[model samples]
Target: MNMERRGFPVWSIVAIVLIILGAITAGLSIETVPEGSRGVVTKWGKVTGRTLGPGMNFLNPIGVDVISVNVRTRKFEQIEEAATKDQQDVQATVVVAYHPEPQRVGQIYTDHGLDYEAKLVTPGVTESIKVATAHYSAEQLVTQRAQASDEISKIITAKLAANGIIADSVNLINYQFSADYTKAIEDKVAAEQLAKTEEMRVRIVTAQAEQAVVAAKGEAEAIALMAKALADAPDVLKLKQIEMMREKWDGIMPRVVGADGMSLLMTTGE
Candidate 1:
């Protein structure tokens, strides 16, 4: 018996080639989105308005593309110079922390495209700062930097939300004013402190004067009371004089002069 062997048929070879090509296309069509990212699917340069979550995703192998969108928190920093309510120039670096809405990335890409930070977040932060700064004067902005940051964040959050972006936080990293303005503020604060010191000194002096007046009045009243007591009891004076004599007398007769200029003799009491 003789065994016959033949090479692979031409049709089978073509079929294998086609199958390899198909496998390659299929591999290319599947996308693996990393953590903290989402996908926006588009067909023929038009968004399908479908969003994909993290992990592996499959799509049609032909004419369909998936764009990866970073849903993680991002930051955009810009220096904005705006006028306060008092028409004072304020320059600050505004840092905005934001992320695309994971569920709305498709809408975000469709409305604002991939450069949404420049188109939306940056402008949103700038305008929000401008508007929020207008609500306060230059002095207020400096004194209430934290409050200004909060207000700007609120404004930016609302503004961006409508466009499918989430503004996490807004921070006024650095705030500045004109040198002359800062000097003026310092001088004004010094003057206010000086004025307060003067007022305190005046109050102290006034209190001292009042205390002195009360002390003098008290002394005068004491003197008046003594005089009244002495007048009401003239015998008290005689008793006091007697006590003085008793303290000073010796055991001998004494000579005294009367008010009428007459000499008188007095004997010490036994």
Candidate 2:
């Protein structure tokens, strides 16, 4: 009876041990890739070049590991400093949207590992922005912001593509300049406005001066014309004298005469 009981107990222990090993093996062999993610398979601490899509992935349980990488669009912001073409220091906040090429996730893992943003995207963005900023002056950066962003996006796209990342967009969010530079720009705008105002005032004064000169010329011309008309006709002077005599003489003539016996015209009251 003791022998039979011992034999049954040993079989039971063996079964239990086998079950545990099977469970452990299944746990290591089966990997579930979450939605919007890809699994990178590595064997013996080396990339196996096998990429698993979303769902259950089965692999050799021995000497195998799987890493999940998100393939969805993600954004990261970076504040970087660069010098403009005119040697002005500008601080820019840049936002980058990107995603791992789903098919190339394995390559990305091979090249940059899971920390793709830090190793791959970040350096590309920094270099591209610096290159682009160096092509524009401080004022051109503000005025031609769209062109600058496009150039940055193009440069970064090419850079990240070489490393298995797809760059969706690169945007320049904000720009910060030194206080002295900002104040200088403000002062320049103010001076330009003041100059425009002064120019308008000068134009108005010149117009008024021209009008005054025309008015004076017209008055002088009218007076000269009247003097010329009188000088051209001697009969006009004689007519003026006759009209004055008629106005002063009444119906009666003067009886007193001078020594030469010439009659003097006079009014009745005189």
Best prediction by TM-score: 1
Q: Estimate, for each residue in 51-141, the C-alpha lDDT of model 2 and write its tens digit.
A: 9999998777788888899999999799989999999999989898999999999988887788999999899889988998999988777
Most lDDT-accurate candidate: 2
Tens digits of per-residue lDDT, candidate 1, 180-265, equal 99888778778988999999999999999999999999999999999999999999988999899889979567779999999799
Residue 113 lDDT, candidate 2, scale 0-100: 81
How many residue pairs clash (N, CA or C atoms closer than 3 angstroms) in each of the candidate models, in the order given?
0, 0
Clash pairs, model 2 backbone = none
lDDT of each structure?
0.86, 0.87
